[model samples]
Target: MKVPKRVYEGLEAVRSSGRTNMLIVSDVLRCARSMGYPETAQWIEDNRNPYWEGIFQGFSPSD
Candidate 1:
């Protein structure tokens, strides 16, 4: 599944902000799912950090 460049870039920006939490990540994933980007959502879910802060890093389509 191919994710749009804008969507991928937005996700990367959010992940790089250094202020994300699980709730924010969940909201992002939910939005992705709702916007017909299940693969992107799943990619986010798979790559999110396990810690409470900095919920995501190294956002990439090949990860």
Candidate 2:
């Protein structure tokens, strides 16, 4: 997917933090499996943020 510059930068930061990208990816996929992130993505996307946090934000999508 074509993501924002800040998102790419954040992913770099996360990777540099000693956490494998797979770890984060797994978390997001796990959450996505239980409940899709379309709602959160839409909510956050609707209100654009200068900084884009990664997929997992501690709160999974309920619906």
Best prediction by lDDT: 1
lDDT of 1: 0.53
Tens digits of lDDT, candidate 2, 1-63 = 335444344444444455354345544334433343344333334434322343334222222
Best by TM-score, which number? 1
Worst 10 residues of 1 by lDDT: 50-59
Distance from true location, Cα of 29 in model 1, Å: 0.7
Q: For candidate 1, list the clashing residue pairs, or say none.
A: none
lDDT of 1 at 54: 33
- Residue 61 shift from truth in candidate 1, angstroms: 7.2
Candidate 1 residue lDDT tens string, 1-63: 233565465555544554454367677776666556676577666755432233333323322
Q: What is the TM-score (0 to 1) of candidate 2? A: 0.32
Q: Model 1, which residues run further than 4 Å from truth?
A: 1-23, 50-63
